[model samples]
Target: MAPAVVVIDSGENQEFEGKITVYVIVCVILAAFGGLMFGYDVGISERKHVLKNNYCKYKNQSLQLFTSCLYLAALIASFIASKVCSKAGRKHTMQTASNFSLLGVVLTSAGVNLEMIIFGRIFLGFGIGFAIQAVPLFLSEIAPARIRGALNITICETPTSLIERNKMEKGVKVLRKIRGVENVDNEFDSIVHACEMARQVKDPFRKLMKPVSRPPLVIAICLQVFQQFTGINAIMFYAPVLFLTVGFGNDAALLSSVIIGLVNVFSTMVSVYLVDRTGRRLLLLEAWEAILVVIMVCIFVMGFAWSWGPLGWLIPSETFPLETRSAGFAFAVSSNMFFTFVIAQAFLSMLCHMQAGIFFFFAAWIIIMGVFTWFLVPETKGVPVDSMLDKVWKQHWFWRTYMADDDCTTVVKVV
Candidate 1:
């Protein structure tokens, strides 16, 4: 059998062995730029909503539709990104996504009407779709297995870092209990041997490494689908409108919208820090459950509640395995986009026409997401990427059992 390779490697061990090359950090930072742009573009759209609401057309429903258009295009893009990335490699796929984003920016900047605006939005979605799906997959692939969950989780978290050494002290007895060949003594010796082998290595990173696992196309697809459908996009798509309803002026609403973007980025960073130390379950529960309550209250308030604005920052990111990570993420994003188009474009407007009924609709949706995460989502932080699949596939009635049971979850087993 082939050795299962984990993606993450801690910077600590590499200190004497030679520093983590600048190339790796550069790659991660560049990928993060895609995320940054995604945030900026979304913010720009939200600001435009405020501008239109104050100046042109006064709360135009078409603006929301135009924004929704990008997501629509993205739904198409995400479906293809997986296979493309698998074949083309991460760097190439990201470059393609960047080109689309540039196209969208130019088009939207020059757009004169709704159709032109929609065109720009579509291109933007194309870029975002590619970036969103490809970036995380790249992170998971390159990161060390021991820290895969933390690194993968950080791709969404603004970006963040560990303990456990005493175990080495008791290593012999533990290894004996686990058993091995007659000549083998303990894990400590094995670890020391491995370290010595690495130390004698002339150039570790320079060595050509074989592919350890297939790209996580499936997981990316699932993530994008779930994220979008879960009502996150709906919230973002109509943030200004929500704030306006709560008595904030156009400028105030736009400013708050920017704040919301920053918060999303900030909270992502927080998640990165917590994922490794605290594990994935606690963070998901804290985040989604908190969002659930605030969104429900916003529903009750019949206006854009300031309290609910911060809830967007509480999204979870560790519910996926490395193999399926890409597909899962893409899936969540696409679903969110699909619903953002449907809900924000069709339903939200209708609800607004009713004046007091719209809040209830969003409230209900947020609550459903909270319930799903709290009960069904598994904790994935610090999990080995390859082994994650084993645990996930082991359950005979995985979906049915988890969906039906109020208290059931899984975390990766460390061997």
Candidate 2:
């Protein structure tokens, strides 16, 4: 029998030793550009293409499709990204995403017809699709656990790219270099163990369906769903529209909405410094929303920025073992984009029908999100990615029951 290389439950002694290099910081910042690109696509498609651009002339439903197809394309592309992340590696996959965005930009910029606009949106969707899935995984793997949430969560910002691949010796060397340490024996060993186990599984998607993998998968999907159900997209996607309802003039509404977006970015920057210090669960619990005026909108944006927007991507990134990191994130990203599309399509109508009640509608979901986080979500503050199942999930009160038999999952294969 080949020896089973197990990543034991983390304890104080398990901490990896290293200084986070400036090079790693720079790589994380680059990889985080995916966040910027994703925001740009989601924001610009609505603000520029559907509303501002003259070439988007169409009926209301067609215009809605025009706005939505990008997310639809993104939902489909995430699956494709899983394969690419496994084969091409995270850095190369991010480059490919940028290429798609560039092509989208070219088509949209020169578009004289609706088809060109749709094609452009589709391409941009593919760019962000591949980007959100790969970038978070890359950041989590490369960053030190102490600040992994800070670094990985930052990728939800304006835009970024990434580093490292899968060759064991080379991966270790790169890991040590980025960590600015002479020895990375312990950290690298855990990663190797995870990869070895990953190799025994032929289908990551099917494996994800098993009860053993339920905790991380559940957390990933629920966080994504809750992130959107908070109606941050409504506030984000239609801040200007919502502003207009509150009696701001069109110009003032646009300006105020822009302020809300800026706050979103600024608050996420704050999370980069706070997540590791405070831990992940508290950040989610701290979230709240308000809907009074422009000032209140900015406050709401600030709350979401620190909590779900970035943490949605951040938590899912760190939770998955490298074996299923790529594939698992693909589902998380798809859920996010799908719900985002849902909110985008439904918000205007919800606003029309619910009027002042829309705020109450989103408020109800926030209550449930808090309860869910308190009872079910495991803290991944400084846990190593490979040891997450054993250290975090298997130790949680609710999740521990589901993960009780998780130990038997080790698969043996000849090296």
Candidate 3:
């Protein structure tokens, strides 16, 4: 990193002039561990499976089960994770997730049979479910502190957020520890107001069904669906196999996949810089780059890494109101895990049957998602998470209607 762009609070609030304390950087890295856990399982499982495929009689089915099982377990976890997050706070939720991941890894690494591996994958799935469910919302909440640069600033929740959880004294103490000489009262008040409004809603999940939640929910779910359908995971999950199908030897195929994974990692880091500057929609629109589509595998990996990979999480996490953030994002995470399971389970079959046409199939989805991003998705670059309804959704021409009530006349502005 770079220093963050200064963001003045919109509407009626004082400027947030906090610097990037080391604590914030630590939080950012903490959030990143979940993603690394996810990517590692996807790639490493395939590498091992692919190496042993020659001796296996049912390679496709076994590969599918091993690779896709984690996603299925994660999908189940996503359903329950909303309540856990709502009741237990993000720190506790993440702690639970990491526990599941560690235990799952132990079982998986020590497995002696397919039964053991599949059983271990179930735990891995639960970890994935909880991790994805909490991490994005965590990032969204913390990321607002610095609109640009890396997205986070503390170990525990923000000081003002403790007020929402009825830990006002702790919140103030923690705030003082993290913040320098700058006034955090306005920011504190803003968070409290958002939490107050959220508290008034007895059922955040039920409220998620209302028109106010429709745009972000729709965007969140669709983005996850599109992200998987882009076939990035299909390639990622079966990278070595995909390389072999595309005309590489065993050693070469494995090597290429490793390179692609590295490219994916590097490009994702690039998004940390480009995201706030170029805006969410523009980064998403990078998929429509025809040149990249026709280019090399690393180029394709680079394109997806910076664009869909990061935005899929970033946009959805920041889009919801405080009341529905956890509940809504659960659906998003579930959608992603569900489709990831489907693709990871069926991709090898699809690859064998569809052959060269598989690329075209995913490419078509890429175009459709690109069009969706342009026409339907609103730009959510600089807006605070709590202000999305007023500053982002209500402002978008297509989504504005959903934010209105039955007054038929005077109401406050949305966008």
Candidate 4:
């Protein structure tokens, strides 16, 4: 089993709790809003202010150019998010990202023409791109790993891995003949049994103590990147566009956008409350699946009503550990922006042109994400920083059933 973490609780400490810690939590809450603000700023900024009023004077190519500039900026910034996070650390990267976003806001507010607005939107995209990578990772790291996914770094199988695992478990009778093995079932069973035994014999403590490898570190980054590819950001970045496309007038559309922020805050609180209790993998599986369903419904409701307008509730509360938390978070955050860029700039346009296909290419991707998370993602509930990987690698089934006993909860001397 992974060891538990214990924060120091000094009696009558005067440094925090009353006012100081409140500010800290408040800061964290504000920091986390980089996503929400990105949604609000970039999502609707173009529609009411720029696209509707100024772009009318432009030629066809300029309108397209005007619409696409911010996306290109986001794509570039997202590519930089991981490297920046690794080099600058999470908090600093976030502050930088926020400053850029603020700058974007100022530029947009001051813009006198399409050129200035486009420049502002580009900066906004850059700010959001950086935030998507930094903020989620920041929240994931500072918050307990047991509660990381709830804060936002959801883990899912990479589809390819899940399929192989599923085949190994379920396709024994078929795969054996292809491999020319006469005892296919036995051979496969033996492999499964062997891996299980290895997992069982692997000492959680010993594995935890081993040096971190490059592969898991890379995996953490890739997982976060995949998260962005799911296309949640497409809806977020283009909420007003999507609403306007679906026939909502300007006033209702703006209100719809604000509601998204409200819903996100409320849903995130739910993750915060339940993250420590439910495993990250499980929460991710459920949330992604739910999001996927919502996307499908949106497709069905296309041109008629906006499905689950604005406030997204897909924060998966379970996948972070102190060791590589920032790197993993950076990857995931960047990936989301990258994914959103592709969806908004490419897929949606293609589907909109097609006229029959629902702009939900990302929905299928998320469903794949759900499948991967169900099998390969490990449980990190209540696991301490040092032994977190071990608890997952060891595949301890009994862990889910175990509770923190009072006698076992004492803090060990750090020696």
Candidate 5:
């Protein structure tokens, strides 16, 4: 066998400055507003009485519908967001989502009836779905490969914004702005190469069904399902109720919930530093699954915050080939929203029937998630999106399996 020929343009070998510019930081901060809006909407349900007070004559069911309606709208929007992003560009998609969210906010604030509130909620959901789909995709495309993982996690977990679009020219500009990326043309050419390869396949969805695309897709969807089924949302939704059950008063329970919220924010910040340094696979495999299961609820959240908290958004953005990236992310995001709805709706009932068994049920799922991560998820630290498909295909049956140099010469021998 011969060595593979790799070409490097003369200008591509220059050293990077290794400093993040204010422009890059500002863009990331702006893109992260979507996450802030998402958190606010999810948390605002706890204060539905404000809506009830404004409307004066609403039933309990109507209020429930108002609170949960955004998820439903998001479900519908998720299906179309990728298509829109692909056609209009990521920046436009985000702007459109922002418009939708702004309109929803205005309508909800000035609503005189149930119909107005419902429409407002639906619009807000539509915007959130689009923002959720586009933000990470944009961030991943624009970031420098060295710190891309950290940037994606930071933007997902913190308040970061996006650049303009996915076009090679704009992408190159964004990359040039990042520290340690002295040769923007080479990186831009790589993106072009990926896009060219993607162009050969006429149908993105059909391409995704092929062998090379299947593993990443499976890993992505499975991680999403596991993330939701682990009962994070259930605990988040009913923290007060759980506290009451555990012998705390209403005031204490509410205070406990506030403390949990603070923990969530802090943990998310911690993940920003760890994601790039420790790598996504190690964090998911070792941090959560191997250790932290003692304190039950609090510990579980810590594990989740470290592992799935950022990787859930980071991995799917990087896993898919350029051709199928948009559609693939759409599928993953929609699956996340769907399962979130299912778990949020079913958790209380399961708690009622199972009592102390609910935590055990979630524990079982978390164990399965750990096993899946060890076997299927590959280490993607410092890997480029263009080469991710090849990386996935080169892995052993179990991702952690090790082979000697002689055994790993060719694809066939490795398999």
Candidate 6:
């Protein structure tokens, strides 16, 4: 009998040498500041009352508009993020985001009129959108296949480090330093392949709209929409107000909001630990979707934090093919920001008009989201970034399962 050759996937669990280097740690920390900025912008609305008090000229309606304008600008700017990243590279894009955020902070702080503040918020929003797209992409590009999912999760919650940027040699060196990366050759080759594919594609926009790209893009956009429709932005924007409705004092309500924020941060940490081990599909599908539309704003926030909070950023980054990755992410983030704007602009009014019925509305949407996830959303744990497109194409778009017999094959049965 002829001896069989065993095929070992690069993404399979493997041991590595050395501790995670300080250099890698520093890169992760710095890249994570993007997530910090994202959280800061989202949470700042919690103190909108303080802003209103400081600027007495701002009316309630005006304050609402001011609070949501950032999302509006982000929605518009997300469309441009892919083009910018494709040209400038991920690191430079993040730096650009940081610069815009800094300028926005300064302008908003110094603004004497509504227009100036709004303009500042626009800058802030644009920065956020770019950061949302670039940070995860950068991290995924640099990390090893075994721990790539974990690293991606960490970046999503904390958020990128070095690699790519026309420097494959440097990227390979960086990859070797990360924990669990035994051999950098396969990872490096994949990155090179992805880069080459990206370069060869004549029109990325048309390429992204092709049949093979449709399923992943649909899943990505759906996840983004469902994330927002789960009423995360509503709770984030109006936590105290929502608390007050249940008879809590102003102080207590604000305190409740603080607790929720703490829970969000804590749960995100837990997600980072669980994401790789448990796999993306299980963590996401089994998370608290049913309670998403609960009347208690605190409960909604907790559910969101425990479930979609981290995955919102994770799934979109992982879904698309290499050539269209940036654009796919840009589309996903734009969907997120677009829905964010919708919820932010309409929540209070929805409360005024629909009262608690709005919760039911969100509940219905969450049900749809759950169904979509069950049927779609592959388990991306341990899958190499460059292989994601091939993976997407091999499986049935709506009905497929990851098989234990082989890491790369998907079991598809026609109904």
Question: How do the residues 84-152 of candidate 5 rate in per-residue lDDT, one tens digit apiece?
Answer: 887777777888889999999999889899999889988998998999898888777656455666665
TM-score to native of every candidate shown: 0.61, 0.85, 0.87, 0.55, 0.77, 0.78
lDDT of 6 at 27: 65
Ranking by TM-score: 3, 2, 6, 5, 1, 4
Give a tens-digit lDDT track for model 6, residues 279-338: 898756534332232234555665677568777787677656556778888888898888
Show where candidate 3 strays beyond 4 Å. 1-14, 52-59, 145-149, 152-154, 276-295, 405-415
Quick one: best lDDT, which candidate?
3
Q: Please report the candidate that would top TM-score against the real structure.
A: 3
Q: Candidate 1 or 5, higher lDDT?
A: 5
* TM-score between model 3 and native: 0.87
The regions of model 2 sitting more than 4 angstroms off are: 1-6, 9-13, 46-59, 153-166, 185-190, 276-292, 406-415
Q: Please provide, for model 4 over 195-287, each residue's C-alpha lDDT reduced to its tens digit, 9 standing for 90 to 100.
A: 333234233323223333222343354454454555444444445545555545576556655555445445545554454027999877866
Q: What lDDT would candidate 3 get against the real structure?
A: 0.73
TM-score of 4: 0.55
Q: Extract clashing residue pairs from model 6.
A: 155-159
Where is model 5 poorest over a 10-residue stretch in terms of lDDT? 2-11
Task: Give the per-residue Cα lDDT of candidate 3 at 21.
Answer: 65
Better of 1 and 5 by TM-score: 5
TM-score of 5: 0.77
How many Å off is the CA of 407 in candidate 3? 9.8
Instruction: Estimate candidate 1's alpha-carbon lDDT, on a 0 to 1 scale.
Output: 0.48
